[model samples]
Target: MDAVARVRWAQVGAGGHVARRTSAWWERLVAAREGRAPQRLVHAVLEVVVDGSVRSVDMAPTWGRSAGARRVVVTGPVGSRLLGWWPLFRYELRVVDAPAPPDHVLHVSDDLPLPADVLDDLALVPALTWGRDEAGAGDMWTSNSVVSWLLERHGVTSVGPPAGHRAPGWDAGRCVARR
Candidate 1:
């Protein structure tokens, strides 16, 4: 890394209750739409930061099934491009204006901000996944994986698939879990 090298990460806010509740609502809505029994709920909160300092936090539901629900769209390069432009997309933590690269950070107690793109595409699943993967919060991988599988099964070409894990992820091979 050089002096010009920079990195972007997601911010987990201390106030993410609203987003969590909203995510749970949307999860049920999607489950109902898919004719599946809703079991667990999900939420989304977006936090943007720079140099280990808080910038902004927004907490809200990720999905809006109702007509009046707000929509948020996030579009960025896929694959390796993400490595260079991680900050462009929603992440668990982001540091845009750091003088030096992040050496090692810890997940401290914090509030969760609202997700960036709550409507349209590139939301909910990815945002929640980030929350799970990076923030060590939200167990949304199974639900998100199921959503992607169902979408692909029905030939829905609106959103892409989830990253990591196989088709079922933790949802499958676990009888105690619900889909």
Candidate 2:
């Protein structure tokens, strides 16, 4: 493979239970050279902490640190994240540890509302998840692509593939389905 191709592949990443780094020098160096801020969604970003019987859910800062969260669960293979933190990225679900209290956690999944509490406590949060085609190169994509893809099962056409730099934003006037 060519040098440029290899570098792009590094950015797309492989997905199979990869853990996150406190720091990634290569990603940082590239960001510096590009002179661009990390890609992040300006939409729903919430924090949820599940303790014994009760779940505390709230809106989190746009670039909140999930490191402070206590426990995390994920549905699919995870990988290192280049942009800011979000529940959809699986960065929040990198481990399976017991929670102490006042914890933040995420469960990345193809399914939603996967039994967090005896009752429902699902709320919309600003988040993003990026993925690449199985080949992991120019086919890199992001955001609610899975949802868009799944729509096809229900007879909804996927208008187009997700944009490579997507971190879907929300507004009162705009609907996610239309994206």
Candidate 3:
């Protein structure tokens, strides 16, 4: 474990046009069916300052096997090569050095004082099945789940989305990690 000076979590809007639109529409539909107003949807990513440099931890679509260290690719049902969707369902668990947060960020959590051991554990996140309700948390596994899972694994439980926004599949990740 190196000297981790700062750690924070960000809630950002979906980066892709289709993803943003689809997520918003789905949230609206679910909220209406449940008789509640829709909350804005966001995704979670972590930023850790170790040895005076920033490292980003996030899960994102592979987009044709982009290369980087500390990246692990996980398969999704619809995006699997067996389903003829080679890169579509492929996701990478990225621990990128000196990375910037994605565009359209909604909220950034205050810097959290996490142990160096916790930051070290980021590279060891489980390769859970993406887009599946395997955790029985009543939601599919997603990028949000990955963030939550990593946090819960290291006993960092106080972080979550800010006001007026929701991180879908977050509970699923925590639930799975608890097991």
lDDT of 3 by residue, 1-179 (tens): 44443234343445567767877888999899889999887777777776577777767776754575554534344323354256665676767777766776666766666566555565555555676676578877787887787778867787787778777788888887898
RMSD to the true structure for each prediction, in A, is 16.0, 15.8, 3.2
Question: Candidate 2: TM-score?
Answer: 0.23
User: Compared with the true structure, what per-residue lDDT tens digits does model 2 show for residues 101-178?
Assistant: 321212221212223331121212123333433322222223233333223333334232223322222211123333
Candidate 1: segments with Cα more than 4 A from true spot:
1-15, 42-179
Cα misplacement distance, residue 50 of candidate 2 (Å): 25
Q: What TM-scores do the predictions have? A: 0.24, 0.23, 0.79
Counting clashing residue pairs in each candidate, in order, gives: 23, 5, 1
The whole-model C-alpha lDDT of candidate 2 against the native structure comes to 0.28
Sorted on TM-score, highest at the top, how do the candidates line up?
3, 1, 2
Q: What is the C-alpha local distance difference test score of candidate 3?
A: 0.68
The Cα error of candidate 2 at residue 172, in Å, is 26
Model 1 over residues 103-173: C-alpha lDDT tens digits?
A: 22222224323233211123323333322322232233333332332233333333321222122222321
lDDT of each: 0.30, 0.28, 0.68
